[model samples]
Target: MKKILLLLTLAICSWSVLHAQDDTFKKYRENAAGKLKKAENDTTNRLWKKGATLSLTVNQGSLTNWAAGGDKFSLSIAGAFSGFANYRKDRHRWDNTMELAYGYVNTTSLGGRKSDDRIDLTSKYGYQIGKSLYASALMNLRTQMANGYLYTDTSDIFVSKFFAPAYLILSPGLDYIPNDEFSLFVSPITARWVFVLDDSLANVGSYGVDTGKHVNTEYGAYLTANWNKKVTENIVFKSRLDLFSNYKHNPKNIDVYWTNMLTMKVNKYLSANVSLDMIYDDDIRVFENKNTGVLGPRLQIKQVIGVGFTAVF
Candidate 1:
């Protein structure tokens, strides 16, 4: 009887220890699951936000034995895309944006021509320094997608091509953001590199690059301002302005780039857009006329108006 009791007592002690260990493991698992569920439910801790907008406009016209003095058949298509990805956590922030636009037109008279082409990308990182202020670093790239030509009465002249005249700018600056709709960035020390990858253009020293060189470097002061706002329930406006003054060259002649876009939402899928772009680079030379045979710097302007299908994502 004593031996049997001793054996039973040892068995009972082992079972108790096993049960206690299982309870402890169950509690730990429950705690971990609760923490994970809380983290999943909390959107305030989300680190990244992204959005994009797309627009496509198409125009077609046909003339059937009509004396309107127009092309027999004409078609034009324009597409634009804008997107942004932003991250914010604690005092650190990162923002990236991309914009692309291209347009093509084909007609009986003009044959085929490119109306517009643009590619722009920007990335910025900042650390909060004070209320509505940040110490930031920014990098920007600007280029075109296709070859550009200058049409003349005699013949078309080859001008720019993909990566032929690309601009890359890097700056460490201060950004002021008092509101969500507007921001201004300024930097006294900025480095800008102009790349002319085409051998022909580089040989001619196009776009301020040295003769026979593919890249030109400049030290400059840079300023950029951005604004985006809803003018009304259906209308939205966006604008950006950039200015740069080269310290090694003619600092008095500042480079200017400004663009404005106004969008009116007609419905969920239809919209109207008006865009204006202005640029002035002292190094960019333009031919005055065929007769004058003079090339000089001039202000360039472009305006576009269209109604198109719009999508947001």
Candidate 2:
């Protein structure tokens, strides 16, 4: 009987030990699963990001008596806004950006004139295919916010206005993004649409649209390269180059747009900015000389420098 009791006791102890080990393993597994879920949620939340920067610059000068033959009274004001939103989830990514700028200058000799105007928006969606490479589709829109004019001694000729020369481009391409500082995109098939909403401008066949037509379409190949880098702790540089070739007409005459900017930050609220822009389009004509009455395509260039209040968020 004692031997049988000892055997029963040993069996009972074995059962209890096995039960305890099972419970411990179950709790450990549950804890590990909870931690994994929390980590996944945190990663998902970090996939989306957004930021923006806004700047305003103002300058004024007055002279009671000046020997340099400059404007007696002069004032200039400029403002710019740039913003971006980006998302990444697994192999998919989306990026959107908007940029706006406007400037005005007034002097005793020139009166009030617009010195700069721009509105640009871009959105790109991409799926990763290889190392640092993606299959992407991009949409871009460019236009002006206000009336643009050519200043002359006698009169200011109305040249362009809001929506009068809006451009929309759509492309599906391959993007090569080696790092955060540079990217290149190329598309063999691209579509571009030009809109001249103003009745007068459409009637004059402005911006490559047919006479009296409000819209023009073209099939082309597009290429764009972008670079953004911090040259120093307080300085940044950004540049972009865009090229397009129409497959249907004048393919040899490619359109080009190049922009560059340098920014030096003084603090969280102050900065200095310099920008240069160049554009060339065969369809746009410029008057070379009024006396000769010659009109032809020409390269356009603009530069701006300013020190101003800036905010980034």
How many clashes show up per model? Answer: 0, 0
Global fold similarity of model 2 (TM-score): 0.87
Residue-level lDDT tens digits of model 2 in 1-313 = 9999999999999999999999999999999999999999889778988899999999999988677778899999999999999999899989899999999999998899889899999999999999999999999999999988877778878879998899899999999999999999999999999989999888988888999999999999999999999999999999999999988889999999999999999998999999999999988874466677787788999999999999999
lDDT of 1 by residue, 1-313 (tens): 9999999999999999999999999999999999989987675448888899999999999999897678899999999999999988899989899999999999998789999999999999999999999999999999999999988877888989998899999999999989889999999999999999999889989999999999999999999999999999999999999999999999999999999999999999999999999999998884564577788788999999999999999
lDDT of 1: 0.94
- TM agreement with the true structure for every prediction: 0.88, 0.87
Looking at candidate 2, the ten consecutive residues that score lowest on lDDT are: 284-293
| Native-to-model Cα distance after best TM-score fit, residue 255 in candidate 2, in Å | 0.9
**What's model 1's TM-score?**
0.88
